[model samples]
Target: MVLVYGHRGAMGYAPENTIPSFRLALEMGVDGVELDVHMTRDGEVVVIHDFTVDRTTNGHGYVKDLALSEVRRLRVKHGFGGKWGPVGVPTLEEVFREFGGRTRFKIEIKRGGDYYPGIERKVVDLIRRYGVNAQVVSFDFDAIRTVRELDPNIETGIIFIGRIRWFLDIARKLRVRWLHVSQDLVDPEGIEEAHRSGFLVGVWTVNDGEVARRLVSMGVDDITTNYPDIIIKAIRGA
Candidate 1:
């Protein structure tokens, strides 16, 4: 059976990457929760999707620029019309403490504008400390490679947005267990190729039931979606 992962912790129900969002995902019975992490100025690992807080929170600055204390003061802007709420940005430590043992965590190391030096070490250390079933994933191949170098036992994956001819070749080089691809780019043929090469396939941000069923039929190992309940039902009914 395909595992259901809540994309940004049931982002459709609550603000992305907050405690309430993650709690809702667990309540909905998701097999795993996916979240993004960036290092704050205070050298703390905080969960938030974008490199900056302008999009998701009431504050207006880059996450790397702000200290965790400043970040904590901002409330998540939920839904349309910029509604303020109780949910704030959560630290990675807090996430691991609260829901580490409850579910699997797919932690994406955010590497957009400013690179967080030594982030892999910090993330891997936290995963080990929490003893949670977790995997570190990144669009940056070097970051994934760094994770492998730091600890070969820790599961690592590479995320890609579009097609790549050397996909499996690169994955083999990186020695990664998973290949996380965009839902639009995934196909049965590609899935088969990856599995044949001993790589598990995970498709991200899928929300449609029909699409979820199709991916399941194609033999995807993991389906990351905003609505895990919908996707779980679709897979079960299929």
Candidate 2:
């Protein structure tokens, strides 16, 4: 059976990566939840998609420059408006404490331009501390490699946007067990080859019922969707 992962904790229903959002995902009975993490100025790991809080929250400025106190003060914006309310940015520790052993987690490390130094180590430490079934994934090859170097026992995956000629070979070189591919780039032939090579496949941001059914039939290991309930229903109906 294919696993269903809630993308940013049912982002379609609640603010992405907030406590309420994650709780809703758990309520939906999703197999797992995927969230993005970035380092705050105080060296704290907070859950939010972008490097800056401008798009998702009422705050302005880069996350890397904001202390945890300032970050917590900012309220998350609801649905493309300036309506900032109660939901604040959550820390990695808070998330672990809330849902840690209850479900699986695919933590995407958001890196590039002012990326957090030693974030992989911090993330690995928390995962180990919580003992949650989780995987660290990043588009940055070095980030994934850093995870392996720090703790080979920790699972890691690579996220890619477009097609690559030797994707599996790259995965093997990196010693990653899963590939988080973009939905448009997924092909049955590629998925079959990946499975045959002992690699798991996960597609992201998939929300349509027909597309969900098609991917499930193609034998994807996990489908990360914003609407976990919808995807679960679609998969069951299939």
Candidate 3:
């Protein structure tokens, strides 16, 4: 069966990256969960997709500009696929503790701007120290490289926002375990190269039934999306 990742953890059901979404994904029977990690001012590995809380949270400001305690104070938008609830933002450790060994975690580190410090090292160290290496990812080459340096055997993938030859070069040089590409950026030949290079290929944010089925037909190793029920069913020809 094609491995199905809950893109931001059933984002279609709950606010993405929040505990509600992640737990909900497991309930939905997804193969794994994907979320982003951003560092708060207090050196906490918080689960949030944006560099700031402006978009998803009721508060405003960069996550790096806020403390973990302060970030926790703000309420996340309704992620329950209906009305909002008491659900709130969750730290990476909280998530790990809650979902560890339950499902795979594909953590994408948000390393935008120069404000985030120690995030790359801390994220890698925490996952490894806690033995959750199969559960991490990042668009930041430095972050990915740092993880590889810390543990060469760590399973890591490089996420490309858009198609670029440099990503392939970096993946090759780093011996990354997989290549995560945005669905629109996919090219048949690029995926073939990745497969030939001995790496899994995962496409992200894929919600359309047609695209999901098409990618499955393309023999992708993994598919990350918001609607696991619809997409996974489509992948299975259900």
Candidate 4:
């Protein structure tokens, strides 16, 4: 079966990475959700995309520079004209507590290693504490490597935008079972190649029904998208 994950929680329908967005994705019947994480100065893990809160929220300053309290004060800027109403940045723990059992999670570590020392450990600790089904993934090779080091049992994935084979060596070193590539890379040959190499392929940000159908036919293991409902319907041919 081809699993569908909400990229930043059905971002096409709600504010990306907010609780409302995640909840909406769940309502739409996504198999899981993919969200980005950054650590506050106080060592709290908050969910948001950019390193700075300027783009998505009515706030300023880097996430690393702000304390958890400071992050809580900023309301997320909604795309649907305040339909989500005064949404605040949520902590990873908060998300886990509320929705952990409800859906799987693809937790993307925005920065790890030197940039966010011990972040891998923090995320692993949360996953363990919450006992949720989740995978740690990142664009940074070292980050997911650190995640593997922190907990070998935890599943990890490499995210990149390029040819499928470009990250194979790194994926091998990390021993990751998932290779999450950009939507542009989805093809029958690449999917077959990845499967032959003992890795499950995951494609990202696909919204069009035709494209979704193509990926499903290509034997993709996972599809991450801004619109899970559309992809769900597309795959089911509804």
Best-matching candidate per lDDT = 4
Per-candidate TM-scores read 0.95, 0.95, 0.92, 0.98
Kindly state the number of residue pairs that clash in model 2. 0
* RMSD in Å for all candidates: 2.1, 2.2, 2.1, 0.9
lDDT of all predictions: 0.89, 0.89, 0.80, 0.91
Compared with the true structure, what per-residue lDDT tens digits does model 1 show for residues 1-238?
A: 7999999999888788988889999998899999999999878999998988999888999988999999989988888344425778899999999987999999999872238877888998999898999999999888889889989999999999765335989999999999999998888888888888999999988999999888888899999999988988888862
Between candidates 1 and 4, the one scoring higher on TM-score is 4
Per-residue CA lDDT of model 2 for 23-85, tens digit only, reads: 898899899999999999888999999989999998899999999999989989878344324
Residue 155 of model 2: what lDDT? 87
Colliding pairs, model 4 = none
**Alpha carbon deviation, residue 55, candidate 4 (Å):** 0.2
TM-score of 4: 0.98
lDDT of each residue in 1-238, candidate 3, tens digit only: 6789998898886788878788878887888999888898878889888888988889999988899999989998763544647668898888888877788878887783255777777776677666763645777777777777777876888888877354777888877888888888887787787777787889888899899888887878889989888886787754
For 139-194, candidate 4 gives per-residue lDDT tens digits of: 98899888888899999999998978877787888899899988886667877888
Error of 4 at 185 (Å): 2.3
